[model samples]
Target chain A: MPHAIKMQDKYGKDGFVALLLESQGLDASDIPGFMWKRFPTNKTWLSTSGDAPFQMTGGGLPHAALVGVDGTLLWEGNPNGAPKKIEEMVEAELKKSKSGWGKGAIAKKARGLLYGKNAFVDAAKVVADALANAKDDEKEDLEAVAREIELRREAFKKAPKVLSEDARYLEGVKAAENYAKWVKGNPEWENEANAIVLDFQRPEIVKELDLEKGLKKILASAGDKAPTADLAKSLRTFAKKNDGSRMAARATLLAAAAEFDPNKK
Target chain B: MTLSRLVRGVGMVVVLTTAALAQLKVGELVPDKTFAQMLNSDGRKSMAELKGSPVLIDWWGNH
Candidate 1:
């Protein structure tokens, strides 16, 4: 665990994430950062869990695995025996991160297409083939990496305006949320997600995030006591105020329901 | 190292075992696995969730 911490402290900022998997049946105090350990939440280790046992070779203390940005296992063995080899592999993977990948539409479409198909090594041929059948608008979005060094620089760019420009406030917010699931081990892209959320921070946009929470109470929660006409008017108002939002769609449905509810008209 | 080597350090694909998840081998796709019950990771919870960088997973027992 201490060795893990040392590697983490040095390369963590450069996107080298050190995950310490403490095997079961030992005092938690033995972990490297013992004082900082949080319990109950972090107790179970999944790889060796009964549900799906991971087959780790060299059944001994301090075995390690190095996984790359593309989810390929680069190397795995006793760290003590191959420190130089491990570092060498880490360096090679780092170059990929610093030069490869893109964000926003480029990521969601280009790199995503390649990675989803596990055809990253053959990215150019895949893109060229896909382009042959793509529509005009989709064609504009397609870009291929002809060579490893020429991996599109757009991978690290700021949240593209296409992510938020002219889309409904919530749709824009969702774009940022989706990207949150993609990028990792850095602040620049996370900060980009924050900037995107800020782009849609208008009072109306924030209210839309919780539209359903407030809608039913205004539209029908008063039971039969609430006037049918007044409830209908409020529902209409809420829907109109939040037009194009998902909650607005629900509000429209409830507004129509007012047409048949009993309570003496 | 060559450019392809830098982007992807392709090596011999050594399938260590016959199980669903072959043992950690260079240049082979790692089977996606969830790492639940993590004590702390700034909100990251799995190997799949942590992409766009190199990940060093040190599996050790407290002996």
Candidate 2:
């Protein structure tokens, strides 16, 4: 954990990011970009953790993989044994991508500008200046970049607001997911976002999370051949236990699923 | 109720996640997919999903 923290400290802001994946015992506060692999069912871990983009198969622990700007794996090894190799690869990657992606020189300049300052107005100006003399096709491409920047900027602003709107509880999980996605990456707005994530530890929220763990255990037990009557009976008891809380509703819904039959229609 | 029982229950989805391929090689494209089979922590975009940038994925476990 200390080594992971040190790595995040070293490269978290400098044209690089890290993901702390695959842990059973962790809170959101453990790492800035802490995450886990999420299951496909609607019964997700708050939909907070992301997909394993690597699609990796059998490999032991304490591993590392370096992916470059174009999403290609550049290196893989046990990080404990090959720190120097990882650092050298990172340096090589930075030369290829200071940040952002674009094929042409001017479009590349706008992308680099967008990454450097994260200022849509200034990045848009870079595009506007180029658009003045750009060919028709080039103009369309520049306009698309400008739109992408604007959408990102809007999402950044909206995420924190969405998080703030939801009271910190089981109900706020979606809001938490949104904040983690959009309000992140920008250093200026990050602290405010982190403040919201920390709120998940509120006693009320923690209680609900504990209850949720129990709920997951129940779902795990029901399996594919769960007796409908038995499952519904368990869900009803869970709903009663959860009464007056937001999760009571979720319990009710899961209870209905226990009773639902797909072939009815 | 038992750890072994829980393991057996989860093994049902093992087909969706576990493919016993060799380790990832350099130059392969990493596709973001179902991570439930893979142990995950909290929530954050995979650096690859953040569009284009250099990313170092540290795949350590809770040891």
Candidate 3:
């Protein structure tokens, strides 16, 4: 929760925006109070109930996904887990003109699809299709991914039963695996699932690391590649083709940087 | 710094930025997932309205 706020604070001025979606069927009355205390930022906070984009890709609660200025999804995971990479992408986006990449038709289409209907199922289908094409040896790893998606779907399916009883049970979706055992032990909690007390606890984050300096050092050594002028030309074409996509914006920014000739100018 | 060093620095930023761009597996297309209706102090809002800038969508609850 605090990390999201910190990120907005650090990057908001650089054209970064953060949004919080409460996917659980919680009572809306309690959100403002929670928001006032925990996340005081003016960032958009909304309450959502059924299928969401995060249901497919998120590891758990507090999951954060980064959408680049041009509309591409740059990173998705715990915001704290990859602080440096997030900053790297944000910095890259900030370097571009605000209107350059995000206004294109393709980028808009992609963003719309991400926020549109049946996203979880769509993501699962994507996984299933990829798995179908995978070699036999890759089955185990792919199956694990598929299993997780199925588990989440099952968990989401079981949520209404629990939420109908108590609106505040945030862990109900996650506790689907333990539902059978829990119901057998506590009969009352079978239908009134939210009333069941969970023994599970959340682990605390230990440390936050900064790796950008090291990454910059490695970059300094990576000087030999495509010629600046050639890269700039290719990137401009890429930007025009991709239009409002994140790659195009990033390419446009990079192209300008590459073509900078100090001696000539 | 010397002109050569300055040029190298610029090259480095470009190199690292390109590498970072390559790491992005998912494009910016928003999923067509069913979103619960959004409400706030004002009224209703859609996720699509959040486009035109970098956004961090936190799919979380009061857990």
Report the TM-score of chain B alone for all candidates: 0.57, 0.39, 0.36
Best prediction by lDDT: 2
**Model 1 agreement with the true structure over B1-63: per-residue lDDT tens digits:** 788765554332233234544465578777755554343343344565556567877776534
lDDT of 3 by residue, B1-63 (tens): 999999999999998655433423477466423335443311113333343456776766765
Per-candidate fnat, comma-separated: 0.61, 0.54, 0.58
| By TM-score: ranked, best first | 2, 1, 3
Which runs of model 1 end up more than 4 angstroms from their true locations?
A: A27-53, A101-265, B1-22
Model 2 docking grade: acceptable
**What DockQ does each prediction reach against the true complex?**
0.26, 0.23, 0.22
- Residue lDDT tens for model 1, A1-265: 5555656666665667776666654343233123123221222222333222245677776788888877787787888787777777777777666555543344344454344332342445445666677666556555423332133222322223332222233444655555544443336655765665576677766676567567856834545342365676788898899898867775675566454332221
Global lDDT of model 3: 0.48
Better of 1 and 2 by lDDT: 2
Q: Mind giving the per-residue lDDT tens digits that candidate 2 earns over B1-63?
A: 999998987895684456432346778766654333212222322332343456666554444
Q: State the iRMSD of every prediction, in order shown.
A: 7.2, 6.7, 11.3
Candidates 1 and 2 compared by TM-score, better number: 2
lDDT for residue A232 in candidate 3, whole number 0-100: 57
Name the weakest run of 10 consecutive residues (lDDT summed) in model 3 chain B. Answer: B39-48
Q: By DockQ, highest first, what's the ranking?
A: 1, 2, 3
lDDT of 3 by residue, A1-265 (tens): 6666677778765546666676555444455434533443434545544334534364466677887654557788887678788777777766542323223333223223222321334445545666666665555555644554444434444543344233212333334434433334333434444433222222210000012222223324334343345555766775676575434454565456455543331
Q: Is model 3 an incorrect, acceptable, medium or high docking prediction?
A: incorrect
Query: In candidate 2, what are the lDDT values of residues A91-209, reduced to their tens digit?
Result: 66665555556656777777766555455555777888898899886777788677767655544444333332332244346545554555355565566556666777778777777
